[model samples]
Target: MDPKPSARVRSRTGRALLGAIALTALLAGCTATGTPSPSEVPHATTPSPTASDAPPASDELVAADADRPLEAIDAYALCRAQTYAFYPGDFALLEYAPFDEASVLLRGDGLWFVYIEVDDGNRPADLVESGASNCIVGGTIGEPKWELFGVVTRGEDVVDDYDAPLPSA
Candidate 1:
């Protein structure tokens, strides 16, 4: 049989446990058990490319209907696929309405942003986490003819406002 822990050792161990518990609570937001709750830890988002791909020697965005938001989403997808390795299959999101929240982080910047939720080729079996990730596409909204400002987030984690803007001319 081993000897019992000394009073000093017990105190140190208890202090360590308390410290760990405090850290867990701090990070986990509100949890009765001091564990990581689902909402506490926001899901991670797919990362975006650092630099944007330049337009194909043209400033005009070719589309059947420039007024249709779907067309712009398609353009965004097309542009994003070129830079991001994981893509092409995320087409279903083309129908979703754009979530405009681009300038929140970069206030005073005249550019407006549009966001779309992406389906990153995850099979039905792979969706264990069941979290949503949105992509950021920025441009001059309300312009008669809109040009693709850039692909910001390809369904990546957005901060105050998605910071990643893959600017293409």
Candidate 2:
């Protein structure tokens, strides 16, 4: 076979190159003013929290063994660990957006609330409860004095409900 491309193939390649050049020129002319049109600007398909719309900080300051009745920091750490274990590899929680940190709050009723932002559709409440339960070292009849409630969300939508039973670690 000849090393040179066939005439038919050469003609098709030349046409494709000319088509690309024409498209580039058309786009350049459309943006000749150097500023992109409103239609040309990319828009977000999902709602994200802007600087002013950011959620309030955690209800209480959480630190390991802080001067609090319950060790909230430990529970939060274990919850994150369990979350990582539940969703390993590509399905990990960190793989999703808006999951930079969790909002942890210890309510007056001795319930710990952990809110995590995740784009994934599934809720990992069992993992959270399992990790948090570890903090309940001793309680009446093996029942934990403090309970954990988890809320998983994506943008403004609540993907996971908080009806999960307490999981023993």
Candidate 3:
């Protein structure tokens, strides 16, 4: 059974019209430049606050804690400023070799001692002492604090020789 010429023409026209409509809908979702249309953009998700975002409840540093290395270094630098009167730019020349030595020491008592050994050669040592007392007592007391035990110089030996304090004891 052969369809009429008019029926065949209508069937072809209907299929073409449906295909054109589908193509138009798809093309409408993208710009001529090929970027996604505004309607096709994904919704933005806002992130919630995490534990890292929260501030510390207490600002104090515990002596027995393992994470106090940076804090200990900071305390040493601060102690140099207050007790020794060493300024930032000039302090390096004083030849404080504390960092060259171990900056932190763990004692048998389970407490940490933050100490810096200073070898101040003659002229630099004189320049440092002129600013203030060469004695440096560390900042905080609860934990291991730096005590000025020895200040060595050329042709002269000076020593305080005090035992280090333990946080547990």
Report each candidate's C-alpha RMSD, comma-separated, in the order given: 24.6, 19.4, 24.5
Worst 10 residues of 1 by lDDT: 101-110
Each prediction's total of clashing residue pairs, residues at least 3 apart in sequence or on different chains, is 0, 0, 0
- Please give the CA lDDT of all the candidate structures: 0.43, 0.45, 0.46
Candidate 1 structure quality by residue, lDDT tens digits, 41-63: 75759665444653331213433
Better of 1 and 2 by TM-score: 2
Off by over 4 Å in 2: 1-69, 90-101, 118-151, 155-169
Model 2 TM-score?
0.29
Distance from true location, Cα of 116 in model 2, Å: 2.4
- Top candidate on TM-score is 3
* Residue 50 Cα positional deviation in candidate 1, in Å, after optimal superposition: 56
RMSD of 3: 24.5
Candidate 1 to truth, TM: 0.25
Instruction: Quote model 3's TM-score.
Output: 0.31
Q: If ranked by TM-score, best first, what sequence of candidates would result?
A: 3, 2, 1
Badly placed stretches (over 4 Å) of model 3 are: 1-42, 46-75, 86-89, 98-100, 106-115, 118-169
